[model samples]
Target: MRKNTFNIFSFDTTIRNPQRNIDFLQIIDKIDGKVLNEKSLLIYWYEAIGKGIYRPQNINAEIRNKLLKGESLSESEIKRIMQDNPQKVQNGFEGRAITHFKALHSQLLLIYDSQSKVVRISKLGRELLNHPYDVQNIYTKILLGIHFGSPIRKENNRARVFLNTIFVIDLLKREWGKLEKESKGILRHECVFVLGIKDCDYTKCVSEILTYREMYGLKENREYIENYCVSNDLKHLKYDTIKTYVDEVFRKFAMSGLIIARHNYYDFSSFESKKIEAILQHYKDYTFMEFSDIYEYIDFAYNITLPWIENNEVRKQIATQKAKELHISLQDLDFNDLTLLENKLNQTFYQQALKSKIEVSQIDTLLNELRILASGAQEKSSLDNIPEPLRLEYLLALILGKKYGSKNLESNLIYNENGEPLSYAPAGKADLLYENFSFEATMIKNRNQQLNSETTSVARHFYESKKQNTLEQRAMLIAPYIHWDVALFFKFCAKEFDSKLAPISISSFITLIEKSATFSEFSTNFDRLFVDKLLRDKTDAYVDSVNFVR
Candidate 1:
């Protein structure tokens, strides 16, 4: 007789006479209202068995050890055990494990006695022992439960108990599948990547991996698949195919409510509009007009503004409420009446801004300073003969010195043999250094390089400077433009540098300085704007960077 194979659900146990007296419905009823789905039912059943709440006669010591030690037995050990115990092996267990294992099998009978404290298998758990492939549906259902099931439900909690079991089973199935050897290798690499194994094959591409990890939740581990073609040197997996796979996964995640779908124009339902209004209410103390300006300027009209407008019924109610507050009749409410509510809201926001020390006079001063800088930028062509990088460095030095009263602003900075200039006092420390602040500038005209070496070099300078200088001192990277590749490299540097360095496009830096000078507000708003560019929406950044590059 052929030796039986072992699987995730398999167990070794002695058989006993069938227990016809057991009440299956009553046992299920005891779990009713608790097991919400098929996944939950499976979990509850597995847990009860694992805890010895259910014990079959002559349970295999190996299976008992696995449960106690939280380890899985090897296939060889399972086969050896089966070969050593011929008397305990049923006729069905004499063959290799099947590809798919269903829930119900003839050799195993679920036994639960009302008077007993434990539930056990009547003919032992022999039927529980089968090939993992035979149970693909069961494992997939369990995975769905673990990924999508609500934790408040006992069923979900139950499903979690079998998470490891399903993981192992799934791995086994993937290994045993009919996929080509190269495909199998790719899957193995992916598994290692997801586990965050330090020595994984994809570790060579750490920068890309880190960027993908940040953009999408690290739990997805789809980065491995995304980089598969490039990493594995496989030409058949075309870019289009990879893109389709990624898009499909993203769509699935969006459907499951794990993430919002990326869209140009969000079609807001009535409920969604109300939800947005509630969200806006949370930021009611912010500068309403400025906030709206920033939102619209970034072209987030569809993504952010429309989502916050109240539904028709809610708008009508708001109009009526405003009319009542103004001591007017409901019939008197018109489009202008709607403006009353908006004005009232803006008034509250303005009051809050005033409390926060934002004064009209300060804003006017900052606006004037911005105009001066813009004029200077347009008129100054004296440094045009210098290399782009050196010119940018000198320009930033001048701007920072003018703004912050730094004495380090000089046009004729020293240059090294490589044509890279020592723009500031300390060589290679930064291109521009002011009081408690360091700036590094990179202005590359070419985009032919696969990797943005200039961006990486400047980022490295920023990182080293921050380490040598006080961690609290502001370190900024000034770049003419940040294309997609450079943006990804920046993200990588952010992770490696502990997020201490900020990337500032020339345009954004100018805008931020203008805002800060005009509003008399803290320059930390630049950090907020940088974050918005990175994570919220990239429309403004993309447009600005494209024009700058051109």
Candidate 2:
């Protein structure tokens, strides 16, 4: 007897036979029968929702139609028809079943994917007329709660029922396909209520959920295929290949309402509700994995899903709704956790660089880092001269690298109009000019002079030639350092380059030599400079000490 049956409905029962000759009256008698009514609808709902047994479809349709038609029942028509059970309230059995699964009944009637087509009773429901109670019904409340994607209501309520449905279905299906004992092979999809690609035939209805980018509408089932690709790590698969795969499974089985709402992809939102659902479903198995582990997984999957959902207006609305409930605002949040001021500064600096505008935020971040380095000096009491100069040089080096987009020390240049070379300069020559004189290289070169020569000169010379040919004259005539002597070196370099029509900055130095790439390149050179100066001063101090002893 190769008879097929639903998971909870079986035909091998005494009450419902193929002949339909059984005494319907006697059957109702044993159950303390009562006339069917809205309450009975609850009982049938319990059987279908709680036990996975399909309720009689015709009966529901009859009730709805009657209610709509406003047909009133006679006193006799409303009473139990069972001759022996006129006294019974449709039998205690009927009442108990309804009461026991009240939670399941409430949820499905309320929010069962209002979009799905109306369903009717299957032949299997008829077969279960007198079947024994099934235990799978126990998990219904839990699965329903999960499926509904709602918060858990107080004990054994509608929300609980929805979650229970999701839980059981997920466990029974084991990730909607082949079950893996290790559980690691299961594809983790980050979504809210997404349909599966396996349910749609892309070849025929490809534009089902076409998005903004895939505007061609070639074969995008909009929601399902994208989620499927994300869950299954099939991102590398070609478009047609994925479309073909989606067509095979989900073509007819559309009862599953797996669509979920999320913020603009993963990176744009803080916490996804679907992540919480996943944890609830798989928490026991993931206990040992750190919280960060799950967080990372959710984040990675979410970012990948961004391109598909970012432009979705409805998805954004839903994401916003969920975020509000969780007390998070997606608009002003970022992954870096930067303060408003800090963020503004960082962004301003980047914009300034892009648009060729000089800025000082680079100056601030560098100064902050320097303050940190200075505060951490190993010998605070000793207060060595090398430390402060080294910090200053290093700080200037970073500023130059950030401002000029080059970090190499050798790229910094200096020259005169007469083709004479000058001496070494700081890496952040541009920043120095902007800060010291509140103007760029051109303005400063036009008005400022070295050693009170208050008027600009047109001496044409390169740093190399000036230092080699007229080093003494150029050094004496070079621009003055406003705050530090090290900064003056860069100013002199810029002024000299402009005089010779070279106009090269430290950035040019980097382009010239790729290896000595950033102001940090000058770290070694500065260190040498620092040590030489320190030794010279120390020698003078030693001689003074010797003279005092004599």
Candidate 3:
């Protein structure tokens, strides 16, 4: 087995960059059963980023900084960087990309097939593929449940019954808060000596975590320890190595809504102590599933069934509502019930080939979600669990695909080998694909942000996408609100290139959706909105172009 080792000295940096976790899983899902070429993943990683679907953070620092400064690497030089160059195999893009991929594997978010020497997205990884809005809450529960002896991790045995060191911190925070009462929360420095050790004693983690605070008078901003003159800790525990993990865990704890991270201290959240007590009681009743093989374990961990990780009431409400709809009530369904999610809130919207699928029929159903999401009050709906932006992006793909005739429509969102959606639609590309038109959408609210970020990119992509087709083709940019000034900026692009491009507010787009049931009506209605209202009308029309969020 290719052991994914974890100890105090080693911490998964992937937790710090959760946006890219789905991005990573999207790529790994492609090469699930492929053999190792060492360079296979680097190729996929670079290609995805090159196409703009992957996060720019995937770029190696050496190349990213230079690219940001307007310098670029030659084609041959780029190829050379991808070759067999170093003993560590971590230079170039491989360094940043592989580090997170391996750590996520260790977290059981992925599965590495030992016999085949191939990596696959585990069940938990697929859960992330489905929902990412409250990712910190979901990840914390998974992190708390898994221990060294979990069936999936062979090398973590040295951790020896240490039930997720992060879980130990949860206990430490609760216990310390009781003793200190009105005092400040647990200090950062003490965690390195107490909870961060490789063999952290599960039974005594509380006492050890508490002992250091009492012994050293630890509190906020009092973490620096120096032998002579150094910001480093005096006893040489290499605080830098493990401190990021501590900070990240504390941050996740805060988001989990059980614990609160305040400045340099950790404490339980404002919710009554009963919430923490309930979590602990259920945690005690939890038992690790001991499957003989790795695949079975992956399937079990895929849908997080834990109920007490956060607000159990909220989870139960969501679960019950989901059950009521199907008329298939079950006695128990946790926070992330697959039945509630599965295809409902997929990160991607791509489906099987559009051939004879009559996908447009589904747009009626998707409009139900769009109505909730567009109102900016997702909390009251079934779509509440997903981020507003992702839900918007997914709905656009499905609704537009069905509306425009699925075969004629193409969505640029990132997907796996199966052509399913995986993450948010990336920039530098026309987000939605139609024959010859550069149609796109964004949930960005600020006027300046839209102008600075999308002005050139949208105009340029419109021109580029249209170059392969016709000048009669048009471009439309949709957002929650549009700035009059931003509308005028795109007008300049249209005038300069002798092309047709216009920006529309999401409210206007929603209006079109409500009015047009077919592609002909959808297309012609938007055409009138573009030309009749903004193109030939007085410039004052531009002022009202920016409307309230739909």
The best candidate in terms of lDDT: 3
All candidates' lDDT scores? Answer: 0.36, 0.27, 0.55
Off by over 4 Å in 3: 1-6, 38-43, 51-97, 113-115, 134-137, 149-180, 197-203, 219-237, 251-258, 271-275, 285-293, 296-300, 308-501, 504-550
Off by over 4 Å in 1: 1-388, 407-412, 415-427, 448-451, 518-522, 535-550
List TM-score per model, in order. Answer: 0.27, 0.17, 0.49
Better of 2 and 3 by TM-score: 3
Clashing pairs counted in every model: 11, 64, 2
Cα lDDT tens digits for candidate 3, 63-102 = 6543322233555545544453332444655555556566
Q: CA shift at 404, candidate 2, in angstroms?
A: 57
Task: Note each model's CA RMSD in angstroms.
Answer: 31.2, 33.9, 15.2
Best candidate according to TM-score: 3
Worst 10 residues of 3 by lDDT: 226-235
Model 1 per-residue lDDT at 310: 42
The sequence of per-residue lDDT tens digits that candidate 1 reaches over residues 77-109 is: 444444544443234331211100111121222
